[model samples]
Target chain A: MKAVGINGYGTIGKRVADAVSAQDDMKIVGVTKRTPNFEAKRAVELGYDIYMSAPDRENLFEEADIPVKGTINDLYDKVDVIVDCTPGGVGAKNMADYEKAGVKGIFQGGEKHDQIGRSFNSFSNFKESVGADFTRVVSCNTTGLCRTLNPIKELAGINKVRAVMVRRGADPGQVNKGPINSIVPNPPTVPSHHGPDVQTVMKGLKITTMAILVPTTLMHQHNLMVELDSSVSVDDVLDVLEKTPRVIPVEASSGLGSTAEIMEFAKDLGRPRGDLFEIAVWKESLNIVDNELFYMQAIHQESDVVPENVDAIRAMLEMETDPQKSIAKTNKNMGIIG
Target chain B: MKAVGINGYGTIGKRVADAVSAQDDMKIVGVTKRTPNFEAKRAVELGYDIYMSAPDRENLFEEADIPVKGTINDLYDKVDVIVDCTPGGVGAKNMADYEKAGVKGIFQGGEKHDQIGRSFNSFSNFKESVGADFTRVVSCNTTGLCRTLNPIKELAGINKVRAVMVRRGADPGQVNKGPINSIVPNPPTVPSHHGPDVQTVMKGLKITTMAILVPTTLMHQHNLMVELDSSVSVDDVLDVLEKTPRVIPVEASSGLGSTAEIMEFAKDLGRPRGDLFEIAVWKESLNIVDNELFYMQAIHQESDVVPENVDAIRAMLEMETDPQKSIAKTNKNMGIIG
Candidate 1:
């Protein structure tokens, strides 16, 4: 089994660590935490070796009733690949340390594409990460877009895509982040970087994206308008999306509507932390009018990238050569349904 | 002053009556109810003269301690106009009674547009209803589109418009309706009739709409994609939307993002029934990409058309000549913020 070490145990990091543990060909070496907090203790409880971020902070874990296996340096030495889930820009700082250890490095959404040679999304660019030293998993928004876009590209050539990314300000546990009472044009500029970031995986894609940050910590909703090179029916678009592994067509008949109900359903389904790892598209909203297809879908902020990280591990380590095999294994092991 | 009576005192009827009561140019003659339910008693408490739909059921109201001032015919005899707020297709049946009484009839969205010569949304076809004998108000979803599209059509020139109406399965008080389990492809067909309903007012406007009913009761979220005649900047689109009378630019800095938060804000603003009479557009999500303008907005399914109903009363009676003056008066009286 390929050993995987997680360099952070925050929101994405902890999720990544869990997903890594779920993989068939991968095993978790350890998880690094800066603070000896609840998550650190919980990691220990879950039987994960807690690697303190700093070697000197080992006593902090001891006092906090948390046990540690070693420092992050020890984690790097023990692993074939290390996934960096530190905050934005911090991943870039950690890149050199990863390179020094000679283990492949994987970064989360917060880091810029230039910090890594390639951006990895299982839907489109999983193969591109093969033999690469570093890969950045696209943001939750980008992953959702790519998952839906890949099918459209294969079924029908897309002329252009204009999407509005209605973002949630923070994950549920992120109390520090908020514009809580208001919505803002984040970046306060036209065409937020999401479209270009999507271009990192999809070369030559004509897409312009706008983002609005909302107060909810549940999920981000995307409003997409895609123009096909040729006329297509709404059914044609639905067929493509339905075929995509990560696209779950949400229907009112399922007694679920709104992100709130979706979360409730996840809990009912016994999802870890009630996370939905698939792209939830409003099935009835799909339409082709005057040669244009319109639809809306919700992206669960924290968990969507988790499955992609699993697939990325296989790609970085060359464990599973087939994309579908890796994705299916990752999804099945994580109990992810689309 | 135009004398107006509401037929059927449920969701749309009661709201229409309250809006008429708020209008300086109109007065409520009475409102009819078939059942002596809580809404009927509440209408009495709100100082509306309650009339029984079936005069024979007058005893039901009397037994329920709800006093009635008159019968449906008595309301018809006194009012110059009657607004039909009954269930779908019931408005068509009531059309003849309105004609027999020599009173103009206003139908809500539930009615088929062909029941009346024109479908009215104050923003789009308010003027067309002037001097017309019968007018049908567009659906709440259509009202939202018209509110946003009118500004775009005049300011940027819309080449085509495509939208997905993510609907609420029922109103907040509507405990009866739901597909609740799944998001079914409603109409199960392409280009649902909402676009045609909008066309009835906009006149040859090239637009198409698909609808998905979700299990939420608060409001309906509309995803809109408009192809502009020319390339406009994001600021340019903002400028036009700002000028629109009933379009509220939703900013995250104000701490509101989801429809639920918008409702909370509305209640905090002291709006009756926590009703927002304007279209709430996520301002930051507005973008002009590749000359295509995209955005997302929400319509409080019950109250969005309330102000429009007030304006439609004026239109049918020729009370206020300019549509803006009527909409402005109604909005100010109802405390609607654009």
Candidate 2:
């Protein structure tokens, strides 16, 4: 099994560790934390091969009730890949440490798109990340857009895309960051950074996005309108979307629910961490007037990038030429694919 | 039988004329027009008692081939109620003319909110206009909001309402107004008039509305997040909505379609003048995190308000009392309300 190491065992990191452990071809060799938090203590008690000392809590593992031992460098040496789940830009700035350790690394979505060698959404363009030394999992919005747009590109040649994204503010963990009662223009400027990021991933597609941040922690909803190169019906578009592996088309029959309901559905479906495809579409909202305009909603941001990190790790390991095929094989070996 | 006079022969007026003609208790006295338009000529040929000339074309009826002939004042005298399908503010200014002729009047939505004695939205508060002399129809956006809100109010008392109304620039007939590419803020300001108008008619419900106008002539889509007075589950909310009259709960299974599809569905259901209910909700979009927040999209204006005008006319004439009762009566009278 390819040994994997995770840095930053927070909510996302812990989930990533769990996802990696579930993969038959992968093993959680170690996880690093700067402090001995509840998650770190739990990871130690689970008997992981190594518990790398975070800079601040360098001696916590040795003082644990059931002592765990390892220096950060030794933990890095044992793993074939390390995932930096550090917050935002910290991952890119400190990526050199993982690179020098001779282990391939993955960066979180918080890092700028340019920081990583390749940016990826597992279902949209996983194959493109194969053999890359460092990959960045895109922010949730980009991941959601890729999942929605990839299917459209494959089936419908799009001429232009216009989107209005209603984004939720910081995750629950972040404190006092929003104008909770008002819908604020993110970046408080036209053509926000989130919009450009959408265009960057779907580089060939002519896409423009406008974002408004609402006070919510659950999920962002993208109201997308597209002008396709040719005429297509709503059924044709739904067919293409349904075929995309990672997207869960919010059905017409399902009564309306919140983002939490969507996430719950994702959990019940046995989706791996970061594999939540909560696309809630309003059928009446999709208008293909004549052959020119098509409307839809794509949801994404930080939380969605989790699965992309996992896919990037698999790609960097060079275990599968085709990422989907590799994932299928891995799942079969884990007895989860069937 | 009440003799109903149509003061304009535009799309709405013509439709109103047909609807009234079908009513057993209502008879078309005459239609007034500024020019000898095809609709006016058709109404004349159909053996109407008179064809009144608009102020500018008072002499046209004098030279008409058909026997039907009269001045605008003459037609006003014969009808018990006059339906003013004139453009915005025009009906308000001309209200005295109808009252002077001893006629009760129905004004279209374009009239200012306070100009007429009462504002009518058949299902929500038509009975309030039972004995009222003059009634103005509410705008389409307000009509859609009322329809959506009324059901929710019945289930859980709404303490506050926040809405983002995205409106289309112009209707299909207004094709001369092109360059429908940009999404412009409606009213280009906060505290939009549309919001307060809805609040006024909702019996002083605390509501704030923000609007964006796009370059499409289709229906408007409202992104509404309401704060209820009490907590309610999503299932309970859906159950309440599904049973609400005039508010058709569109399920995810119905698939996606445009405003036109919704209009077509209303038509197929034989909804009178297509004044039926429409609330296409994505179950995942609703969030009742606390006792407060609920998010949804209200139907845009055109398809919504136009039919509301028909209901307003019925309410003005005291043809029905309760909006649902009126809708049922009107539908049955029109051979559609089973």
lDDT (Cα, tens digit) per residue for candidate 1, span A51-151: 88876886787888887888888788899998899988899898998888888999988999987868999988789997678999998999999999888
Q: What's the lDDT for residue B42 in model 2?
A: 80
lDDT of 2 by residue, B13-89 (tens): 77667777777777787877766656667867675655554554555655755445567787876877888877777
The residue-level lDDT of candidate 1 at A255 comes to 63
lDDT of 1 by residue, B1-338 (tens): 87899999998888888878877778998999999999998998899898888868867888999999878988888888888999988899989988988989989898888767688988787788897889998988888888899988888799888776766667766667764433333554447788998898898899877665554677777667788997778787788788788888887456765677788888998988888888888786676766778787878888888888888888888887799898889888887778
Cα deviation at A27, candidate 2, in Å, is: 1.7
Chain B TM-scores, listed for every candidate in order, come to 0.97, 0.85
| Candidate number of the best DockQ | 1
